[model samples]
Target: MNYDIFNGDADGIISLLQLRLANPVESKLVTGVKRDIGLLGKLTEKVGLSKTDKITVLDISMEKNQTGLVKVLDAGVDVFYADHHRAGEIPTSKHLDAHIDLDADTCTALIIDKLLDGQFHYWAITAAYGDNLIAKGDKLSNLAGLSVELSEQLKELGTLINYNGYGAIVEDLHFHPAVLYTALLKYASPFDVIADNSSPFYRLQNAYQEDMASALAIKPDHQSDKLSIFELPNEPWARRISGVYGNQLANQNPKSAHAVLTENRDGTYTVSLRAPLSNKQGAGDICSQFETGGGRAAAAGINALSKEQIGDFIKAVEAFY
Candidate 1:
């Protein structure tokens, strides 16, 4: 059996989408909420795992899944990994084909785009937008001769898909990531999704507007020249909107870093950190200072940050910028 293990976010979904579109495949999908990077472990426990199995991992960090990766490779399963996150040390196994580019301007889909020689460049551009690579997406759109209106449509589609991945779990989301990915797979182009009012694109677009409206109404919990932080109450809406809210804030003030903290059930906070757009560096490093924190340079996150560490997290961001 072939297993498609990917991050639940837009980049992860689109990376796999491009691959499957180019070379159709039937594989079991493994994914979860955007923060659920510890996915390979789930596959390791599969009962029928054997040498004939193949695995393709996208967007999630190789560093975070090292143990499961080693276990699977040792079991003789061939694995292909593509990501733009902070990969600590890639495993040197013949069974592993790892494509890791930690460039702030790139995402997993873009790496696959290059690998496929841009066979599905439009979908790659949408993933870039969803990953919050605005300038990169805009540049690519121009290179593709996309009208401003068309680019905006792709941007909104990407943002909506990205926003849908933010919930604490699948139930908090409007559609499970796997379901959403399956629905989207039928469309060869993002424009088709936008044109079909019955598509998930419209459903997510409507939901995104409502949640973003609520987020925009709230003021920052802490604001400084270098950093801005917002603390959200423990609610499903808060969880769904946190990550995309951080991206919106970063775009609003490109010079200041942004952090959106959603209160968790266990009296902790789930942090979505975005580095200053002008200086897209140090986000992953600053978040890495805390436990349960990891991501790419431009954007990173903490799954659960205790109240006591909030001040320190702020100070670290301020110091870095």
Candidate 2:
């Protein structure tokens, strides 16, 4: 059996899209909402334990999935892993093929683009945009000789795909990540998805606009020179828009860090933290201070944060920036 596990967001989906497009494969797709990154352990729970099974992991943090990865390797399964998040300690195993780059400017799709020799460069660029690496995406677009209008089109497409991924669970999402990935796999280029009005791109675009409008109406709960925090009520729309809204806030004020927190059912909060665009560092470190927080430096998130710890999170962001 072959399993493909990836993050549901733009970077993860597009990374796998580029790889499968370059090297066709029949595999079991494993994914969930954008926050669901601990995936390898789920694969290990599968019924069969076979040394011949192959697995490909993308976008999720190796540090978080280390236990499952080690277990899989010990079982003699062959694995290919690629990501840009913090990797605690890469295991020494011939069964593992890991490609990890923690540079804030690069995303997993771009890393795959290098591996595939840019066979799917446009899709990779779209992922970069969706991943909030706006400047990097623009640089790659210019190198590819894309017109400004075409670049904007890809940006919107990427943003919409990314917006679809931000939900508390698959039920909260506009479309399950696996279904979205399968729909996108039909198109070799991201532009093709834009041209096809019937594609998931259109559905997500409409949904994103509605959700974003609701988010835009809400003012920041806390604003400071170094950080701005917005709190949203516990609603599906809030859950769906939190992450992308954090990106929009960061883009609006390049010098100020931004946090979008949505109330969870347990009276806790789901937090999406974006480092200042001008200084893309320490986001992961700040979030990692929390029990349920971990991600890349440019953008990190906490699955659940207590209402009491809200002040501490803000203080940490302020002290760092």
Candidate 3:
């Protein structure tokens, strides 16, 4: 059996594309939403333990899936693991062929594309843009001869796909990410899909842009040099647009830190924190002060913050900056 598994976001899709371009084959594909990075263990547990079985894993790094990776490789399964995430300590092995790089400027998709000798540079460009590595994105874009407008379109699509994966459950999203991935599977680029006007990507793009407009209007309650806290009132669009709202805020206020608080269905709030992208340190630490949140130093997330404690959280965030 040959298995193809990926992250289920733009990066994952692009990584899979690069692999297919380089070594096209018919394989059993295992995938889920962007948050399903830890699903590798379940796959290993269920799949038959056969030495001849083969697997290709991308985007999600070995460090993130250490135990499961070890189990599958120990079974004598031939595996190719390619990823770009913070890996503290990667195990050394022979069955497991690992291609891992944790550079903020490079994502897994681009890594695979490079490994494949730029067979899927266009897709790699989109994945890099989606991961917010514009310099890398442009490098691939220039090499692929992609138009500026087309690059922006893919960037838009990538951001939308990434944002849709934010909520704790699929129910919180405007569309299930699995369904969205399926819709995108047939198309090579977002520009090709949206160019026709009647395509589903166009409709989704319009909906996402409108929701973004609504979400961006709210003013931050406490704005300072180091921090800004923008609160979203209880509403469907607000919840749906929370991540994009955070991205937009982070862009406009590039030098300052931002905390995006969206009221949950239960009356509490979910917070997304981004320290200055230029100085992305300690953001994950600051968000960990709250419950259910951890990320890199520049960006972090919190599942639920009590409505009453909103003020105190803002104070801590300001102090952290």
Candidate 4:
């Protein structure tokens, strides 16, 4: 069996999309909500591995999935992995092929674009936009000779696809990432999706506008010279929009770190932390202080943070910058 496992966000989805478009294949799609990085283990638990099984993993942290990766390799499975997150120590095994880059401006899709020599260049640019690497996306778009209007269309498409991945669970999302991916696979090009009136692009665009409006109406729960914090209710829309809202906040105030905390039903919080855009450093370090926290330097997250530690989290971000 062939397994195609990826992050549910734009980078992961688009990364896999480009590869599959370049070389169409038959594989079992494995993905989840944006925060579900521990996916390899889930696959291992549900489907016992075999010596001939082939796996492709994208966008998730190799460090977090190392255990499952080792297990699969031990079982003689072949694996291909690519990502831009912090990889503690890569395993040396003939069965594994890994591509990882820690550059702040690069994403998995961009990495795959380099590998494919820009065969699906526009999709990679869209993924960069969705991942909030705004400057990188714009530069790539310009180099591709895309007009300003077309660039905006790709930007919106990328942003909407990215926003769809933020939910706490599949139920919280407008469309499951798997369904979205399958629907997107029909289009040979990103522009084709935009041209088709029945495409998911329209549905996601409308949903994003409604959710973002609600988020914009709220005042920051905490604000200081170096940091700003916003608390969102426990609704599905809040869970779906938290990450993008944090990105918006970071872009709005490039010098100040921002936190978007969505209340969980269990009296905890789901935290999305973005370091200052002006100094994209220390966010991963600060988030790592919590047991449920981990991410890249510019953007990190805490899966479920206790209410009592909210103040401590703010202090850490404030002190870091």
For model 1, how does the per-residue alpha-carbon lDDT over 1-321 read when each residue is reduced to its tens digit? 899999999999999999999999999999999999999987787655899999999999988999899999998999999999988889889999999999999999999999999999999999999999999999999999999999999999989899999988899999899999999999999999999989998789888889988888888899999999999989899999999999999999999999999999999999999999999999999999999999989999999999999999988999889
Q: lDDT scores for all predictions?
A: 0.93, 0.94, 0.71, 0.93
Per-model TM-score versus the true fold: 0.99, 0.99, 0.81, 0.99
Identify the runs in model 4 with alpha carbons over 4 angstroms from their true place: none
TM-score of 3: 0.81
lDDT for each residue of candidate 3 in 60-85, tens digit (9 for 90 to 100)? 74555788888887777888988766
Query: Whole-model lDDT for model 2 versus the true structure?
Result: 0.94
**Tens-digit lDDT track for model 4 on 1-321?**
889999999999999999999999999999999999999999999998898889999999998898999999988999999999978889899999999999888999999999999999999999999999988899989999999899999998999999999988899998899999999998878999999999999999999999999999999999998999999999999999999999999999999999999999998999999999989988878988999999998999999999899989988999899
Residue ranges of candidate 1 with Cα displaced over 4 Å: none
Q: List where candidate 3 sits over 4 angstroms from the true fold.
A: 45-49, 139-147, 174-176, 196-198, 233-236, 263-269, 284-291, 304-320
What TM-score does candidate 2 get on C-alpha atoms?
A: 0.99
Clashing pairs in 2: none
Q: Write the per-residue lDDT of candidate 2 for residues 104-180, one digit (tens) a residue.
A: 99999999999999999999999999999999989999999999999998899889888889888889998899999
Q: Compared to the true structure, candidate 1 yields what TM-score?
A: 0.99
